[model samples]
Target chain A: MKKRATAQEVAQLAGVSKWTVIRAFTPGASITEVSRAKVMAAAEQMNYRPNLLARSLATRSTRQVAVFVDDFANPYKLQLIEATTAALQAEGLVALLVNINEHLDHVHAILNADQRQVDAVVLLGTSFREETLADSRLRDGGPPLFVLARDSQLAGIPAVSCDSAVAMEDICRHLAARGFGRPGFMSGPRTLSTALGRHRHFRDHWASRGIEVAELQASPYSHAAGAAAMRAYLAANPPGARIDVLVCENDILAHGALDVLRHEAGLSVPSDMAVVGFDDAAPSALPGYDLTTYRQPVGRMVETLVDMLSGRRPHDTIVLRGELVLRSSA
Target chain B: MKKRATAQEVAQLAGVSKWTVIRAFTPGASITEVSRAKVMAAAEQMNYRPNLLARSLATRSTRQVAVFVDDFANPYKLQLIEATTAALQAEGLVALLVNINEHLDHVHAILNADQRQVDAVVLLGTSFREETLADSRLRDGGPPLFVLARDSQLAGIPAVSCDSAVAMEDICRHLAARGFGRPGFMSGPRTLSTALGRHRHFRDHWASRGIEVAELQASPYSHAAGAAAMRAYLAANPPGARIDVLVCENDILAHGALDVLRHEAGLSVPSDMAVVGFDDAAPSALPGYDLTTYRQPVGRMVETLVDMLSGRRPHDTIVLRGELVLRSSA
Candidate 1:
């Protein structure tokens, strides 16, 4: 009980060879019922579980999962990893964390390669291009691969994502409720699939709702862009240049808008100009910002991501609802 | 040519089964030279690398490393993971991420049993308690276990840690260079052996340099504690209450001081109050607070942590020298 009760000790008590003790835990592993019962009884007395390294010779799955994330330093990614790791641990699956840069080549390598010790791969979706999924390894035959918040045409590779379509609807409806008719959208780069999907879905939802979008398209997703976009929009439509509500693709952009509203544009959040953002990140909670945001449900999303691989969850596209946290910024 | 080719395809092309292809990659594994050359030639043709799942079968070492973190959402832990994961991946090892919340008993059980298929464990320095290490799986001859900036007595567990002794010296020397006398420390809980070690080392080093610490340990390291300590100290000792320099444990705590300084105490960072923080986090780089701080070499530490695990590194304390990043805060 110092750590592991030796197989020799189990053998000594059960009156059998160490090999017999090893065979008891090996699944689909053949051993006579009498010997198996004796070994199992002895193991139970000692409260022993066989070493996976030795018993894996007789097992099907290794109970290990690989988690891939694009920038570890990004607070948002960190939150995802936090919940995902916890979820994996609860099911007793080892979460193999892989740090990948913004490179599709590495992702393709993961998909095509079956030589890595991981039982499966969990892609923490962030700015993935469609071509990245085109890597042949992801096409059905590869070890069960799951993408977080991304959808792919390939079969069998399941995905767990937030309902971006519903998220957009919530944002638009919130804007209208705030007594703002013309709400502007400042988004991220057009290349990244998340940004693109959000943009298209937001537009389609708004169009169906009968609200004509005033200003749309990509912003740099940085503070400078938020300021520049706000200034440019006002400059062009100076006469009726009044967009009382603004929707940002993410929290950072919304932060920039808040600053621009007070410092540059001489406006305030929830007063002269109402704003909304996605990803209820930590910054939104700070005393200075307190932004009204669509909470990503990071806990549920990451836990569900882990649940999918362990067969505790069905291999399916899961979309969770996001709650809008009404804070001072809105 | 695009990525990795699977062993199954290589075996088919080589006119052999998958087991024969696996034996070719297994070190000192039994296989004929003629068959070996034939398999290698076929693998070369297919551009194949044996995946970790297949490789783990032959070798108990899964090329999977487990990093047990205290909290995932902490930006500091995120930085450590980024560096650690990237470093492990560079050596072709997949990092298994685990969060040990309350159930240390079960967590250790999982690690000892190899439930997640990890080959090694790296405890996050700040989060891991000493008691946790004393009862680790490494003691049971399971797998290589390492800790970051951990205490002594974990014999043979390779550690890559920040030289907090050197960090304190650098912070003290830098503050002295800025013409500040009687610098005070606002550090957190020493529950972590590293945090306690830093506090002890800092006090001794500063005293040796003829600089008496103006402030003793305030409750613990936190935003609330930092602000509370400052307020209490000012109330008690009004004349000598405001020290010219304040060296905080981290950026978060330093931010707490900023709030106290501007709003509560009526002082500015560098002008009226000189503050320095360890861990030059992103907020330190922002416009509102350009904090002069120590940039923990998380990347270097992570690489060393992983390398030590595979016996590619020496079993000794590798101290990383944190740089003093001077900004407007100091």
Candidate 2:
């Protein structure tokens, strides 16, 4: 490997102090433009770029954020990852992606992020448990924690997500208008507080309108799991006694449920069974699916997350409203 | 912010040297078991984990790999990202995700990764251009670069990807057996050498069997782009003049083509027009699509990449054969 040009070498070439060379590269550091130009020219000529990892020791800021994501099977997570990474990059912050699904538990992911000394940690999916986070050392002296696209019940850990209560109200109102009396809600195996909170909002919103919602659980957040859950639901309940509409917690589950209803159960949508999903996934707009779902403002949520991390916004739980997209399915 | 416990404090509490504390935390560092146990106890009590960034300065290895990904709309990229991050994490290396789509060009992403002093850089998608990479400073003393799921033409940069030649031959034989003479190939706008390489392999494989393949180009790798390309093709050529089979470069393109055929064009599969795609994405297995596609050995490819990055394997171009998954689409 070729030896990299050090700051001392660049300073010697530029006829400036090593500290001047450092200040020339440091963002927002006080340095004359002439000195900065000379240092940059010398550094460029010598193929020398300031090592961020080395400078991070003195500044105590790596300008890298640990982005924890799970539920890779969910297509919506892709949009979340893209938006979060892009937003972080726009703010000159790099995203250190931590695969929460690969580890034995979420605590391992958190501890690993802590060891890296990232500026902050952002949880992007819905799989993290509040209890696990509370019990972890992250709460003691680790980097600041922020949640995106899911509510965080842990104290001092700010979160930005869609307004699920209002979204549920919108969904229930639409279903009531369509005269769908009985509705079934499909959710994943995660027992996080936000998951339960979404279920409660969904069920309570329907109950207020004199309708009871049934609950269905999928083991994991995948299309196949959704189909299996729907298949099992059909086997347990006769067609005449089945729910009129199915409301899935996310779009992937909804796609699975819709497939089972159309192919396995031989049922027509909106006539025999209507289906709805959340997160208005990319496929939901396609003609094949034409799914009626709620669109979470992922771009806005990511912006809020970046702002919170950069101290541009207050570190508190912020909920943004999303639009309910209507289609033939519901 | 609370002050983090330093190595000095941990060493004082453990009655050991500061170097001993670092050795205990390092993976392959030499330390006595008694000293390691004492350091561990002290670390747990004081919550003093050795900072990886600080350690990277002395060791010159950050144990961080820069993973660059583009074309996020293709669902196959999700599987690649998950597998790569999981494999890297399992090997005690963190993945710093660089969003190539967000940057002005691939060169910016490379330079950003270079600034971080990552141990290696892995390109996970096919959108990177060799000319752009060659023009960048990456060719001049940057970290070792590796390409995953795509062939790299640059000298000394190793790549691991599916064998496109064999895959095309398998596809062509299947098409001939089905008596489909006229076929169309749909590709994205990336003009990289590998993109043209796949096209050449497909066209040449079909030509050797006395069949000429038609070409179609999609500006971007998205469902909407695919649909637009298919719609344009159908508009330009009427029913009798259209190709018998449409082979998409990726699953997302095939999905768009399939949706247009079924809904807008009012054509049936394998009768009026048959469609095939590469990369058996998650939705390809759904009953709604049931797409005939190629399945890349993502797990095995990621394992090879990690091994190559860790110096366990030689830095050479590896072409692994993928399977031709048959379904009703073709």
Candidate 3:
């Protein structure tokens, strides 16, 4: 391999001091345009690239942030990852992504993040429990921790999440206005605060109207679980017996419920069983499903997350609301 | 905020030297059990945590690898990201993820990766072209670059990619064995080598069998593009006119084509028009669409990529084949 040209070689070629060569490459450093042009021309000609590793020794700022996400298969998590990484880049911070599952391996992953000396760490998952937040190892040694899209309210730790309570109320009201009486919920796992809160709101809102609600919680936020739950519910209720609508906590669950309705039960959607879901994932908008759902403001939520990480905004539990999108499913 | 405790304070509390304190915390560093126990007790009592950034100045290895990926919405890309991150973590390296789109932003992202002084860079995308591979900026000053899942053959650069040509040949033979004739291809954009090679193989194999093929190229690797292409094809060919099966270049496109067939075209999947796809993403196994597709060996590919990055394997173009999975769709 050919040896890379050094700053000293560039300085000699440009007929300038080493200090001028360094200043030309440094952002916001004061240097004359004539000297900068000469240095750039010489560096370009000789393929001179500054060694950032050596420079970081003097600056002591790596400008890197670590982001932890648990569910890689979920489309919502994927979208959040995209937005978070882009926002980090906009702020000139590199995003070090860590795939932390609910298993014990996540503990090692978190410790690795601590060892990397990231500027901050963003916890972006729904499955992280209070114990994860309360881990002394994560709290003491790691960089400042912030939660996004999950309700993690540990001491001195802040979170940014979607306002699922208000959205659920809005959805319930919308369903009632459409003359839907019998309602059922295809719920996600109760371990997640977001799913638990949404389920509670759904039950309370419908109970006030004197309507009994039926619900089943999927083992995890997955399509197969949704289908299995729906199938089990149908086995008990029998076909042609009515549940006017099924409100799914996530789009993936709703897709599974729809699949069960069409294929297993031989029931037509909306005409026989209307369906609604949250988090307007890409597939829900397709012609086959056309699911009516709530669209989370991921772009705005990511901006707030970056601001909190950079200390530009206060560390508080900030919540954002999303509007309901009506499609053919309802 | 409380000021963090230092190694000097721990050493004083433990009645040991500063060097002993440092070695006790360092991974794999040799120190006596008694000294390590005393240092740990002191650190626990005082809430002391070593700063990695300060130590990196002496060690010179940040143990970070930057990964560049485009098209975040694609499920295949998400799967690749998950596998890549886990592999890097297994090797004691942090994955610095950069979400770059097909725009000028990727150029800046690459430069930032160079400036961060990561140990290496891994390009994990199918959309990257020769122009991106040949950019002098990436070649001159950056850490060693390795392309994964793309066909890059630049001088001094190595790539590990899926053998799409052989996989396509296997798929065609499988289809012919299943009594499928008059096959149509839902092609992706022609700029990508993976897509171009797959399309070329399909054409050659079908032409040798004396069968005519219909092809439509999508604007992007998305479900919407697949739906549009299928809609155009159906409009051109009347209902009940023979196009026996549709072979999609990817799962997202296949999902779109299935949507078009079931909803817009008012046709059943296999009985009316069979369909197959590449990249057996999570959604393909859903009950709604049991899509027959090829599953890429992501785990093996990621292992090879890490081996190449760490100089454990030769820097040559390595290709792996995917297996075809049969389901109800075909």
What proportion of the true contacts does each candidate reproduce? 0.52, 0.80, 0.55
TM-score of candidate 2's chain B against its reference?
0.94
Between candidates 1 and 3, the one scoring higher on DockQ is 3
Instruction: Give per-residue CA lDDT, model 1, range B1-330, as digits (tens).
Output: 243467788999999987899899878999999889999999877767765554565565677776777654345667777777777777877666777765555346435535444677677764555565566444554555677744444566556777788888887777777788767777666565344366667678778878777653444445556677777766766644567777776776776676577657776667777888778876566554568988888887777776677677776867888788989888
Ranking by TM-score: 2, 3, 1
Which residue pairs in candidate 2 have backbone atoms (N, alpha carbon, C) closer than 3 angstroms, thus clashing? none
- RMSD to truth, every model: 5.1, 1.9, 2.7
DockQ, every prediction = 0.39, 0.78, 0.52
Q: Indicate the residue-level lDDT of A28 in model 2.
A: 100
Model 3, which residues run further than 4 Å from truth? A2-22, A32-60, A105-107, A194-196, A239-242, B3-17, B26-30, B46-50, B54-57, B193-196, B239-242
Model 3: per-residue Cα lDDT over B269-324, one tens digit each: 89899999988988898767799998888898999999987789987878898799
Q: Which tens-of-lDDT digit does each residue in A250-304 have in candidate 3? A: 8888988888998888888898989999889888887767899988888989999
For residue B329, model 1's alpha carbon misses the true position, in angstroms, by 1.7
Q: List each model's interface RMSD.
A: 5.2, 1.2, 3.1
Listed in order, each prediction's TM-score against the native is 0.82, 0.96, 0.92
Using lDDT as the measure, the top candidate is: 2
Residue-by-residue lDDT tens digits, candidate 2, B1-330: 467898999999999989899899878999989999999999998988778888888898999999998878877788899999999999999999988884458887888898899999998865877787786477777899998888888888889988899998899889889898998999877574344366788888878878788888887888998999999999999888999999988898899999999889889987899999988998888887889999988888999999998999998888888999999999
